[model samples]
Target: MTFFAEIFEGLRISWAAIRANRMRSVLTTLGVIIGVLTVTMMATAINGLNSTFQTSISIMGADVVYVQRFGWFMDRNEWLRSRNRREITMEQVRGVERQLTTAQAISPVAMTRKDLVYQRRNGGAVQIIGTTEKQVETGGLNMSQGRFFAAAEVEGARPVCVIGDDVATRMFPNESPLGRRLQVGDRTLEVVGVVEKRGRFLGMFSLDEVVFLPVTFFFNAYEQRPDLRIDVKVGSLAGIEETREELIGIMRKLRKTPPGAPDDFAINQQEAFVQNFNKVGGTIAALGLFVTGLSLFVGGIGIMNIMFVSVSERTKEIGIRRAIGAKRRTILLQFLIESVLLCVMGGIIALLLSAPITLVVALFLPAALSPSIILIALGVSITTGVISGFVPAYRASQMSPVDALRTE
Candidate 1:
């Protein structure tokens, strides 16, 4: 109770001091405000981006791997070597299904961009994917309406199609998209199913801006010899490493590669993407740390300098208080509370400024002022205040009453 009372009294005196020197207090708080703002916006942007990236990649299926012509992140030398490798044909995809023991599902995938049409409406430049019914397993797909086309339909070169949320909404607003004949590129395809909304990819490209069709029909409509991507889903995530090795051996055998030569095919997976993203994230974290440290150092020095000035200006006041039998702890608490109040004010102002900026970022990502970051900002402000104010407060507390009184 005694400690609380002292703190309350200190706060009352601190508020009075601030009110008496309003302009000085405001200018002193400016440095803290800039520092807090830098700390907050950097944390919030990274948090939002991290969250968005994780959600986007969740649907990439950790248990799945892609056998593609090239790696996603490749150097010039690797790209040159992989460029002339033989394309993965659909027959190889079928052969893998027959021979592989670890794979749960295997799909031969191909893609192209085309304009979509339904009645008078046009959805410009949408991604169209060609794959087998096994894509439902290889890709993380949840059908919101109707059903995926039958295996027989896929083998028979049927013109049935599955549309994503964006396509279903834009092309058939007032009616069910099922059984609706939609024109993709120049060929007409009936919409047999609609995919559930799966948000954007990396908070940039819309995953919903895609349509899936049977590879047989796709080849008929688009290119006769389109490059293929073989998607393989293992029975479990633990089995993926062995599954990749099996795929390499199968491809090498099919191509009849000479002994001791490097494998020509690339087996890409979600982990490769995650590894690359981590490197980029590390760079961003380093940069943010550097800027935050510099700002806090400059800001802390300004607070310390201003606090020393405050102690010098009030030497006579300190002398009078000491002569009247005020304790050293009370004097120290008074200065410390004053320093803390200024920083709290700056933190509040930075939060107000950050709200609109966070909202603007939310337009492009899943960003908001999470509760954790708010606590962090306020906690940083309080810590900075204590460190910056300690020396000035201790000097004021240790002042010799006679010397302080004689000065002014």
Candidate 2:
């Protein structure tokens, strides 16, 4: 017979055998279902998290650079121990503005969490961001109701505020927030604008809970000197790297660092954040794969055990086939095909069940259930079926027709 003809015969026999033992077949397939579901669902959640991060950071513009006392993902304990580190000051921000010709816009930021009160209405702890008007525009924030504070308001330390969605919902649930007065740390500020609802960055971090005011206002009210972080927006994508290098050199000069002295400030780009996230995320993905592989390994073992039993129960039938000019390879292929079909069927069932769950998640965030992941899952299941069925297939194929038929 032709190679295709033998394959057809093997598939025919495999399907009939599986059908004859429907309950066993279903039980075997259940193992693969668990394995595939665990892996695919984990992948979906990871993909969603990555999507959220990219979207949130891209909103700040690719060319924008943030200069601060410390990098975002630097170990907190280590940063704190660096006591000799110079705090970035307002003077440094001004120096950057004057010295960095490549920079398009620069603004300082200071932030704290404080209780907000609008007359009798009260908002719980909210992020009080001390920033300039340019900070708003450079950060890509939009005003939903009013406008951001002016440069004059910032320099004068005026009590003008731009409230976020969370504050508006809590402090002025039923009224327009604009023109209202809100109190922050014993200082009453006129709510000049309500910012559009910028959704949460990660699943755990909320941006809409912020209130923006001048950094000078923050300095005046808190009476505590805080490290200032400068936010810079480059004019174009091509100028981003040049802008960063220029700003770093300017900061070094302003800080009066000698030729050999290390720069005291940190310059951060969005790609740095993406790289940090991916590093941590890659570790998590590795752990998830290890765990999912364990489950798949267990399923493969179960398939091997059941296939052994199946071969034992069908010994007489096998011997009769072998006596009727069936080759040993034919017997091996038949059993292997049966095992693979069982796993592939389970994979189909798993895909059907996971599709809906993936859709629901994608509704809230971008999640790719790509063809690659599907193909990987199928390949794993098929490999499991083949590897685990190997010994049983070999034993059955090696059986002598007279010895197999004499049993019982």
Candidate 3:
């Protein structure tokens, strides 16, 4: 017979054997079902988190660099040292901007959280960002209505503000927020523009619960020395690294760091944040896979044990087949096929069960079911079947026809 014909014959025989002991076959597959479900769910959740993180960081503008007082992902000692470092100020921001030839836009940002009231509708704990007119360029925000605060307004520290989409919807649901007065702290400001909707970051923090105003106005109203963050947008994507180097040199001069002295300020970019996030994500994936592997290992052992029992119970049948024209290879193929079929069946059922579970998880966290995950789950199941069935299949193939007939 041809190779394909042999495989078909083995499959037919295996299916008949499984059907003859339907309950046993079903029970044997339970282990694999549970294993695949655990693995698939874990993969789905990890993939979802990765997808959501990428989307969230994209909103921060890949080409923009933030000059801050403290670095992200610093060690305890480094954090303590950075905490005592001088705060980045607007004077330093201007010094860097003056020498930056490769930069497209530069904005100094300061932020505070306060309660905002507009006609009895109150929004508590709203982030109020104080920035210059260049903020729109540096931030990559698109206007939904009206216009961003003008250069004149920022220079004059005018009582004007641009609200985020969530602020607009919640605070001004009944009317267009444009040209409306909103009380921020003890001062009342006019709403100049509304930002387009940018969804939540990491499925937790609301990106839209924000208010943007002139940095001068913020300093005036709060009367406090707020730490400033300098945001610089590069003129071209290819020149980002060059601009970063240039900015570092300029900032070092502005901060009056001695030659060869370690720089106090941190130049943070979106890629740095992504690299840190990837490290975290990779650790989570590794830990999850380790736990899931134990479950799959247990399932594989169950399959191997069940396959050994199956070979013992069908010894007489094996002898009868050997007595006929059947070869040892054929007997081995039949048992192996049966074991693989059982695992594949279990994998299919797990996928069906995982779909709804993934959907429910998506409602609360980022959870995705991708095609690669399905393929991997099925492949793992098939591999487990082959490895677990090998010994049993070899034993069945090695049986002597005479000895098999003697067994009752």
- Say which candidate scores most in lDDT: 3
Kindly list the per-residue Cα lDDT of model 1 for residues 188-284, writing each as its tens digit: 9999999999988888888898999999988888988788999998968899999999999988787677779988778999899888888988898
C-alpha lDDT score of every prediction, in listed order: 0.87, 0.84, 0.89
RMSD of 3: 1.9
Off by over 4 Å in 2: 1-13, 75-81, 235-238, 319-331, 348-376, 394-408
Candidate 2's TM-score reads 0.83
The clash count for each model shown is 0, 0, 0
lDDT of 3 by residue, 1-408 (tens): 566787898889888988998998888888898989989998898888888888887777788988898887799989877787888887887787788898999999999998999988877779999999999899988999989999899889999999999999999999999999999988999999999988888788888999999999998997457899999999567888998899889988999878998888999888887898889999999998997898888888888898999899999888888888678898898889889888888888889999999999988998988999999899988988898889999999999988976777
Better of 2 and 3 by TM-score: 3
> Cα lDDT for residue 108, model 3?
91
Candidate 1: segments with Cα more than 4 A from true spot: 324-329
lDDT for residue 216 in candidate 2, whole number 0-100: 88
lDDT of 3: 0.89
